[model samples]
Target: MKSYKGRGVVLHTLKYGDSSLVAYLLTDVGGRRSYMVQGVRSRSGRGSKLALFQPMFPVEFEGLESSKQQMHRFREVRAAFPLQGLPFDVRKSTMALFMAEVLYRLVRESEPNEPLFDFVWGCVGALDAMQEGVANFHLWFLAHLSRFLGFCPGNDYVPGAWFDIREGLYTPVQPAHTGVMSRECSAILRDLMACDVRLLSDIGLNRSQRVEFLNAMLVYFGYHLDAISAVQSVRILREVF
Candidate 1:
């Protein structure tokens, strides 16, 4: 077996028997991969190791890799970034769950993508430290994430242009298909594309507006990546934010 060392963000995990876990992670060295963590769920203090596998938690690990096996085994693991607010705060934790689910669904490749990995790694830290405009963080994340996913929407918003989600562009004529955003929603998306993380607090939206835009963005994402069509954590995120 080949030895590997890298940083990763936990996407999700599943119980394996009574003493092990199957953890899925997006790693800097190997995009998305699964690891069979042994004895992490045992009733002894080893169970505490499960904390390292929380949704979107960043960790550095040394592991053994094999050409014939899909699930690797970790030799050692530890937190890469100690988050200050994400674990204890309800809103941040909920957002982390949604983000993790989205990544798990959409980032299915096992090939290394350094740029994408860096973006997600930075966003995790950003979310943890963010104080204001936390409600809008996920929207910002999804919009920018599309850029890495290769389907970022065009920011050409004129007064009456509709956003053709299926085509990923702005247009003056209404799209015949139902996968289109109204001019109002299109403008909001345009703002999201231009807005920076530091300026999120300035972009204001009520709960209803936020939910509508999030749903619209999800529709746009679905057109490009079919796997993200039904994100389960979105409901809980909406209620919390």
Candidate 2:
């Protein structure tokens, strides 16, 4: 067994027996791994709260990685920091709910990617710090995530152009394929592609605009990744928005 120390974000979890859980985590050092966390329900099992394993929660852990087994065992763990605004704030909470599902489905690799890990950690922290204009953050995140997922959409959108989601580029005419963003939505896409993440709040989007853009991204991501069959939190995100 190899001893490991790393930071990670919880992506999903499943309850096991009565006092334990099976958690899927995206780690900075180990990439993706699942652990059977014990004593979470009982007060006697190391005092580690089950909330530490909730979706999108950032944590630091010490664990054992064994070559013979796929599921690793965590010896100890703690929250990376208090994400003050995410849990209590409804809009951010819904966004986090939607995003955690997306990442759980999209980020499947089990190899160390420090850059990807940093981006995930940073964005979660950003959401916690942000106080306004959260309406566009999810779309912004999806657009930027394409860079790491190997299909960064081109920013060459023109007045009459449609964005071919599968092509990840713009064209004067829509493609024969079903994957395309409308002219107005395409313009929004270009702006999002060009704008920095920190300045996403500066861009104004009404509720319809937000939903359309988010749906476009969902379709785009679904076209590219086979694992993302559906995003269940999308409707909830929209309803809460």
Candidate 3:
């Protein structure tokens, strides 16, 4: 067995039989890997501690030689970042679930992507530190995700030009009944692209505008990516925050 250690986030977790769990982890060094965690149902199990059910945890694992592509066995797992605030807040929890679902769907397993991994690690930290307006997390997350997925909004389009979601370019004519934001929406998006998660709460869109913008962004994602569903957390976020 070859052992490795690094920082990681729990992207998804599922029970295997009664006492064991299969966890999808996004590691800083290894990109994404699955680990078979034992005794997770027990209170004192290390699996319980190293799981992604909690945010911002450190992990150590050993890969088995029998199946090079199978889930690794975890040796040590612990929370590297103490989360005092994000878990307690409803908005933040909902937002976390949404992002987790998105990552679970999008991030590939066993690929080395340091930049995307670091972005997710930093995002979990920021979500923990957020004090107000947690709804803004989705905006920042989506914008950054676009950058990573190579569908980032373009800059060459004139202010009045329409955004072509399919082509990922700016156009003079909008498609019929397709996803298109207004000129004001484009300007706000440009502003959002320049800001980080912390700077988003004060970005100045009202509740409805935020919801509309979020819907448009999701549509933009669906236009580019396959099988991407409308995020469930969007409604909960609008209802609470």
Q: Each candidate's TM vs. the true structure?
A: 0.95, 0.93, 0.86
Ranking by lDDT: 1, 2, 3
In lDDT terms, which candidate is top? 1
Candidate 1, residue 196: how far the Cα is off, in Å: 1.3
Q: In candidate 1, residue 32 scores what lDDT?
A: 97
**Per-model lDDT:** 0.91, 0.85, 0.71
Model 2 error, position 45 (Å): 10
For residue 131, give model 2's deviation from the true position in Å. 1.1
Top candidate, metric TM-score = 1
Show the lowest summed lDDT stretch of 10 residues, model 3.
57-66
Model 1 earns a TM-score of 0.95
Candidate 3 colliding pairs:
none
Local accuracy of candidate 1 as per-residue lDDT tens digits, 41-68: 6575744788899999999999899889
- Pairs of residues clashing in candidate 2: none
Task: Estimate the lDDT of model 1.
Answer: 0.91
TM-score, candidate 3, is 0.86
RMSD of each: 1.5, 1.9, 2.8
List, residue by residue over 1-241, the lDDT tens digit for candidate 3. Answer: 7666677787678878877788777887677777787777776664354344442333444443235546677666656667767668777777777787677777775778888887888888788788765767777788788888778976565767777676776666776656677666666677777886777777877777778777778788888765457345556767865
Q: Rate residue 110 of model 3 by lDDT.
A: 72
Return the lDDT, model 2, position 134: 82
